[model samples]
Target: MNEHYDPGQRRLPSQDFLSEPARSIPIRYRPDVLVVGGGPAGIAAATAAARSGASVLICERNGYLGGALTMVTLGSICGLYAVSPEHITPVVRGIGAEIAERLHTYGGTSGPMRWLETASLPYDPNSFKLVADDLTAESGVELAFHCSAVAVTREDARVTGVIFEGVDGRWACMASSIIDCTGDGTVAALAGAGFEHDVPNGQAPTTMFRFGGVDVERARQISRPELHACLERAVASGLSLPRTAGGAFSNQPHSMHLNITRILRDGVPPNTLDTRELSAAEVEGRRQLRAYLQAFREFVPGYEGCFIADIGASIGVRESRRVMGDYRLTLDDVLHEGRFEDAIACSAWPVEEHGAGRGTRWVFLAPGTYYQIPLRTMLPEGIEGLLVAGRCASASHDAHASMRVAGVCFAMGEAAGVVAAQAASSGTSVRNVDFASVRADLLRRGAFLGEDRLTQPV
Candidate 1:
């Protein structure tokens, strides 16, 4: 009767296995806190831990940071603000606000732009990468780029170290505490942690792309509904479009960043963990872009002269493996404004689900209200000495849709970093760390955790 039970159970394929001789991998850096993945969550976790006076090391598969913001080439930073008819107020602060301010200072963002019922900050991916580098460097967080976590070292229920394969070959890094910021829960899965991976009912992945030579004024005038209508027209004319309604933002002149083009295989979302399917998805994603370019040029008003400026290095996976943590956030929690005693972060982002259909499913929260994400959500259910943050944190599929955005990930990572640092320094299990102390630390850092009531417009 327990949902979290047998979280890792799945259908297995009958395939021959190979045995390799055991070889010892060379030990690398042993920091106080080892944060895996250099995306928004990893960046925040490493920086926060380092700032908390812990020696932190972050390993990234790509040479650059920014995760989805840079690698997937997302157009805008979502989940940072709470929306109402009269006001758009920030709900996620601390590291998230700092990153936004820094991005603006670098001329990387178009401030906050309101669209539909929400507001998001449009940013340039290159500037985002620079901002990430500056944040980690200033916090004294060491970085190891081009490293992919392949295995995890566990002492009973505790994850002690991680094995990674990089350009230099396989190496091991030990730590007092580990944070799994890899969006797909890579480290947790390898450590035999329970996780939920529902490919059949999972949100479909997208291939983000950008267009140049656009009439900015004309493009800006086209609202979401109008764009959908235009795409519908294209569809009626025998052009295939998996998703007609999606996000489009412009931070530069004569250019548009598009979050369009849903990628599916055989009418279903591809399982990204499978190498053969993942490779096929990448090729399929690019192939969809060509069709979209033609659709925009022929049907859309301002995109008649538009050409493909760039495509994301990878497909944007909205959902994958979600680790089973101490508590799984639910849809009721998001809609009913769930608060927690050990709350670490707040999110006002709506439940935005992309499925195997032309339109997405969006369920918005009440105006000017938000839900608190507790620190327990990041603590793996039966695992010690490890924290899983970002999209892969414990949550139901619906709750994950809302908290999976960049702003919430930043908040989660920041909290996890602080907790990890305390655990490592005090030689305590992450679950045993004092919640009140962690809450105070987060409050001192300017994080909004739904404790201070905001003035809502009547």
Candidate 2:
């Protein structure tokens, strides 16, 4: 009577079907300063706020903590530091620096390079997820994985907490303050904040992938003209390129994150649902990826024997909803390398554009040039007790291109955390917090808070 053998037996019902009293697990709502996201920015913000002595809670919708890092296999952390003015400006400090440092110790990243405007170091995505979780947990920040923040609860103009949707079903959690690190500006928009990005149609999109057994050097040898020629021939011969957007061709070991496939879609307003018709985009992306690889084999020298490795679990969405704050950082500021009095973080990452659906445009900062990101950018306009980090921070389309890099976002997260902690300690909104004290504390904590090449204390 093999218990497993069941010709007459039926599989258990997918749902609870037992005719008996059912037990319930109490729904837990525990986050003093709830941060909605667990990516690099969210992790940095949550960890710093926890260190600042608040019971932090991080709601990461994904099963994993590292958002883009794990999902996209974003192997490198770009823009943490830069070689500007002949001296490296290590703007991404504090928890972000600690993470980068620890990863550097593990040989996950390399030192500053001249070719790339900012210093980018490789990282292990799996290990990064573990480290982020460990840091948050160690700091006593309760994290909810597989839990998405679907809606927000607001009081007047301030955000009070969030509504979560997950396996446990819908639940609510109240918080003293909230940080929108969702990259897409989830909390901000839900709280009725204005956001904008490139209009008409957002730049082409890209689906990143990495493969093994690649001839790194040989692949690098393929010229743009050669690629264009092959692509032209392929089109003429009935092969088609993907219609998705283009992004980065990030570095990898014996492989690379091919971000060449670009798709163009309209940039919808914030709070409203973003449905730009991407259901068929991924399928077309895969088809183009396979086709392009085949083309490279036939035409390029390095791709003779290369094959696919692994596609990203989710698409690497670079640009999205940006919070409308008191001060909207714009292109003119970037052009003049403006530094501000209330600057929270500084960045030298260039204005990186991916596709030309609207036509790719790049405006590079001169050597030794950098710009400041003010605290005003984090606080949504006409909103109190809320902050934004990551790609959702206040910036014009072109400015977002420069400041939305991972390194810069990490710095922004750190800034948000410190400000949130200070405000919490003094029982005030971030806008009313003592700027002098905040700046002093950030400087004391080794965060880069400088004005005119001078670091000042309160």
Candidate RMSDs in order:
2.5, 9.4
- Per-residue accuracy of model 2 over 365-401 as CA lDDT, tens digit each: 7765678889899989888888898878988878887
Off by over 4 Å in 2: 1-27, 84-89, 116-119, 197-199, 221-238, 242-253, 265-276, 451-458
For residue 399, model 1's alpha carbon misses the true position, in angstroms, by 0.7
lDDT of 2 at 216: 74
What TM-score, computed on C-alpha atoms, does each candidate reach? 0.96, 0.84
Which parts of model 1 are misplaced by more than 4 Å? 1-15, 455-458
Give one digit per residue, the lDDT tens place, for model 1 in 323-348: 99999999999998999998888899
Q: After superposition, how far is residue 367 of candidate 2 from its true place, in Å?
A: 0.6
Candidate lDDT scores, in order, read 0.90, 0.70
Task: State model 2's lDDT.
Answer: 0.70
